[model samples]
Target: MIKKLIILAIIVVIAVFIRNSPYSEYLTFSYLEENSDALLAYVSDNRYISIISYVFVYIVVAGLNLPGAAVMSLSGGFLFGAGFGTAFAVTGATLGACIGFLVSRYLLGDVLNTKYEKQLAKFNKELAVNGYLYMLTLRLIPIFPFFVINIVAGLTKLRLFTFFWTSFIGMLPGGFVYVYAGSRLSNIESPKDIFSPGMISAFILFGLLMLVPVVYKKVKGRV
Candidate 1:
């Protein structure tokens, strides 16, 4: 109990620090646009160091559920090209999501389970049956908040491996889009430029496609 409290406290402190830090200000499209030249130069000069630093920052931001993951994905493309950028962004996001999942499970899993036993029982059963499909559908859909998925999944009986692989695979398409956008950072004038209506529609269509199997299974079961 004491240990859990300490972990929770530490998470709170980190969240507060991230919220108040000036560094958070730099995680904006405008900021990246203004300093793209210098950032590119730095990455060019220190390629290995830059990759490590970028991945580390991405992990921290994603793990803490900070608000700059999208920007960071773009920055990865801006700093590296689409190939490396997508790889690094997906890797960092997957690892970061795992951290958030573990933390939520460790801190609040028991409490939530106790409080909502009946609700969680159903949820757990469903997860046990089709956890990966559900996770993939959630990941492919941009409408769902990424951090919320991480935190909520932790409170269930979802396995760590299931969470990790599903998150990685689910986030790949979006990661590629953002990182590719970042690669063309100079052409973008605003966030809207990165995700146009057409692109959003494509993502929504893809997400819905992933749900086909799940829907079919349910229909078949009823039949």
Candidate 2:
């Protein structure tokens, strides 16, 4: 258990260090914007290779909790268009999230469980009861960072299949938002324009609706 926790801690520190270091410069919007067409051209020239490479890289990024996934998602939209981009990006993100989840579950989960057995047990019970609504809320609301969700969800008794499906479906609203924003890249001056206020508002409203059942569950619990 101690060994597992130490390794997990090392991995997270490495991820944070890499993200904060100059190594992550390539992930910035400036870098992406300056080389957009070149990137598009490369992918266009190597379609099958691009898909495989893209998914593989996304999995690595997600699993390791590296930086630039959001930018990568936008790039997916820019290079692949909405339909294909959404499909691939969502698949990649979900798969990557699962990888992160597994790492957390295997490495840190037992330690967390041993340390906080009672609290963790209660939390796991609740998660089993409302994993869908809770995950959907987390996905749509942007209340938490994706990598954090990926790691934190690992410390639970939640089933892997449930985690995958919830993550897939829950991510759709935000995933499509990125894809659509990415698809309009040619017309916009900044990549950030894809997250316009109106669109954000729409997603927030949708998230709130997804939370209805969670709220109901919470109220019932309190009662």
Against the true structure, what is every candidate's RMSD?
Answer: 1.6, 2.9
Model 2, span 34-87: residue lDDT tens = 898898899989999999988877776777868778777777788899889988
- Which residue runs does candidate 1 get wrong by more than 4 Å? none
Candidate with the greatest TM-score versus the true structure? 1
Tens-digit lDDT track of model 1 for 1-223: 8899898999889888988999889888889988989999999999999999999989988999888899999999989999999999999999999999998899878787688788767767777666688788888875668988888788887889999999999999899889988998888888778986876788778878898988987888799
Cand. 2 TM to true fold:
0.84
Give per-model TM-scores: 0.93, 0.84
Instruction: Provide the global lDDT of candidate 1 against the true structure.
Output: 0.88
Clashing pairs in 2: none
